[model samples]
Target: MAVTITEVVLRDGLQDEPVVVAVADRVAIAEALVAAGLREIEAGSFVNPRRVPQMAGAEELFRQLPNPRTVRYSALALNARGVEHAVAAGVKQVNLVTSASQGHSRANAGRGVEEALRDLEPVVAAHPSVTFTAGISTAFVCPFDGEIAPEALLAVARRFAELGITRIGLADTLGTAEPEQVVRSLGVVRHELPDVDFSLHLHNAHGRALDTVDAAVELGVTRFDSAAGGYGGCPFAPGAHGNIATEELVAHLHARGVPTGVDEDALADAVTTVRVALARGRSL
Candidate 1:
């Protein structure tokens, strides 16, 4: 069976960069990844550009994105306003992220868990074409709260399910996760929410992302989120790398006899293209 890969270069990867990449470069990266057979890409975010200047022209980015219908293009949103921007910009999927921990949720989303869920109803109801994904940040552990329980994440997942959210993603925002932890955390939700299609958004801050993938795979999780050249770090979470590299994860799965349908040479080219673009002066 083939595992699905979602490239996060445009959203998560660009959020923490110091240099701004040109729109052409963004298009190039998206085109190359699609050409390499990636079916889903998180194209950009509708968040405030002042906070993440690297993603200044997200609406235009969606308009300029190549063959968006051929491959699913997604964006991250913090609230109803961001969801409105995503719908206006023509994104087919929008991800709403919060945390299981109240402290982290307040710091990142400016609301407690209950308030975040309350905002999600309008966001989901307003955009029927756009698939809504609730990403529970710091699903494993929190910088402020530390060692979040499995019950905490399960509660969030159940609420999203009740709210008619079609997709759910568990984010290791701070990278404080091991393989067993990954399996256990996701296993709990998978057992409880067997009908929910789930994905994992991982960071390589601890260099254990691949191992976490292994654990997730063992639990029958097939969808994963990654970035090119390992580029990206959470702007809100300090000291975290962007995400698992698409090339690296594809290569890992391929080596383990898992079919991912990604062209190895094409993935390498994406890494080179990103490095060269950054070297030549481009941000975004």
Candidate 2:
């Protein structure tokens, strides 16, 4: 099986960090990931600096990125203003995020699920040229609200499809989901939206991320979102930890004879660079 791994070290990986990484460092990290054979990278979120200080220089980071044609660089946008900022910043791709659970949606996006979906309508309509991927956070479980039903996730997936967003990512925001649950939920979504491509965004909080990956691959999911050196967490999702390590995910895929197209050695170097950058930022 072949898979496309989207490196998130520059965005979700650093969103909750105590020390904000410099734009130069973010760009360097992104370049390294591309060198490591990552074709897709989530550069940053177009959000308020006050809320997510680590992502304060997202525009600069995107503006300074080199070799734009080789890799697909994307940013996350929670609202219409964020989408506008991303569009103005020349972002070619954007991830529209909203939680599957209402409580988590309200906390993370400051609105209910339906309200947030309504907010994304115009953003999608306005950006016909830029690729948009809908990310349904807390698809498996929500910290504020317990295990979300599969129907709830499918509903959000349907909405994304209705909005002409064909690519969708299901996020285990709190990392509390088990393999069985992941399989069942993904199966339902896949059955309902057969045409939409699906990706898994997992967290390693409970150390079951790989198990979930195994389940996903069995179901023919070929896209995943991972962070370098396992650095990330959600400020709004209590008990959530870093995403599944990129190197670890790559190693697992390679061992299973799945072609991820990522060079393990180069990926390790990228991970080391990310770790060093974060450590250096902390010292300042």
Candidate 3:
């Protein structure tokens, strides 16, 4: 089967960036990504506007995006209010970010993992019409608490599963996880959550993201999160940056005899669009 790549350039890629792309330009970027053959796109994050000014127009961006019914556009909703904002803006799907590491949970969300998941139970039950996916951040490694064990991931995944979230993404938030760590952590969670479909969200900071991808593919993973220009960083996780570049990921999959159905040429143009919007200079 072919892999499904969720283009996250609009949200995770720009959340930590200094240049705040305008809402109109963000819409153009989304159109370009769709043209590149991406079926699912993470358009923006519905968070505090002042906290993540780059994603300030998250709702408005969705309102301006073309082909709402045709494209599976999603947004990162950190809380119940964030989910409401995205739903009001016409989003049918959302990824709820939760950290498996207690330290990160406290730092990012000002709560423990258990507390965060407990609060989301009502949120998920209230929006039965909207599709929800759990983004388990710092699944393998946490910048604050050091290496995270597989049990941490399993605990968070178990909660999401209880909330009817069948799709969970295991993230290498610090990008410090080795290929073995990737397989080891995912192995434990997959065993207990047999019915759950898991995806990988890797960062390229240590250049092991591709290696982790290879290991996960061997475990039968078919979905991954990536951005066009290898752009992205964790606002809370220090020194956490770079998602595996989407074009490179597509090419790597193609070389491995896997079909991603992404047009590299069109994707290149999309990357250029992001560059111009962010006013690309000596940096990404």
Candidate 4:
């Protein structure tokens, strides 16, 4: 199966960054990503500017993105308000993230898992023009709540399934999941939800994010989330580090003869743009 890498550097990757990058630089980085053959990019998130100051001008950033008709620029929408903001900015794809762990859910979404899922239903119903992906954060473990049971993960996924959502993204928010743990959880979800499509959003804190990618590929998951410069981490989930770098993951998959359709040399230019932006320490 062909692999699809959704680069999340601008949203998930830059949100946890120290220096806030300006919107103009964000547009430059995104342009480079598209030039590198990234058809899908998590361009930004529509959340509280005060809460995640790094993502302050998301609407403005989306307005300035390149190749609007050809490239898929998605945004993370944490709630109904966020959905509204993204739609207003002309974002057609929305990533609805809810934590599988109740503790992280409250920390990230300011509600328990049930409340978070409950709120998503109306939001999904309200936005028929937008395409939504159900992203379950802390799919394997949570910093505050410990290991998430497989049943817990399935329950969260099933709720989204009932919403008629076909795509589900399982996240290892703490970067603590092992190969065996990956097989068990992902296998069961695929078995039970045969009609539902799945993807992985991994981190490299333990240096095993690639290993999990290998395991997921073994189970036929072709879609994986990555970052251009290996930049990522969760403000709510402690211990989470950068995502599996886009170039690193692409190289690993190519070495094994998997096709990703991304160019590494051009990807480096996108990565450099982020590094240069951080180096400048620019904001707003």
Q: What is the C-alpha RMSD of each candidate to the true structure, in Å?
A: 1.6, 1.1, 2.0, 1.1
Query: In lDDT terms, which candidate is top?
Result: 2
Q: Which tens-of-lDDT digit does each residue in 1-284 have in candidate 4?
A: 78999999999889898778888888989988999999999998999988889998998999899999999889998888888889999999999989999899999989899987877789898889898987999999999999888889999999999988999999988788887787799988888899999999998888888988988898899999999889999998888888889999999998999999998899888889888877775544
lDDT for each residue of candidate 2 in 147-208, tens digit (9 for 90 to 100): 99999999999999999888999999888899899999999999999999999999988898
Question: TM-score: which is higher, 2 or 3?
Answer: 2
Supply the global lDDT for candidate 2. Answer: 0.90
Q: Judged by lDDT relative to the true structure, which candidate is superior, 1 or 3?
A: 3
* Pairs that clash in candidate 4: none
| Clashes, model 4 | 0
Q: What TM-score does each of the candidates earn?
A: 0.95, 0.98, 0.97, 0.98
Candidate 1 residues lying further than 4 Å off, grouped into runs, are: 281-284
Q: What TM-score number comes out for model 2?
A: 0.98
With candidate 3 superimposed using the best TM-score fit, by how many Å does residue 109's alpha carbon deviate from the native?
Answer: 1.1
For all candidates in order, the CA lDDT equals 0.83, 0.90, 0.88, 0.89
Candidate 1 residue-wise lDDT, 89-138, digit = tens: 87878888778888788777788988988887776876677788778888
| Model 3 superposed RMSD (Cα) | 2.0
Backbone clash pairs for candidate 3 read none
Candidate 3 Cα misplacement greater than 4 A, ranges:
280-284
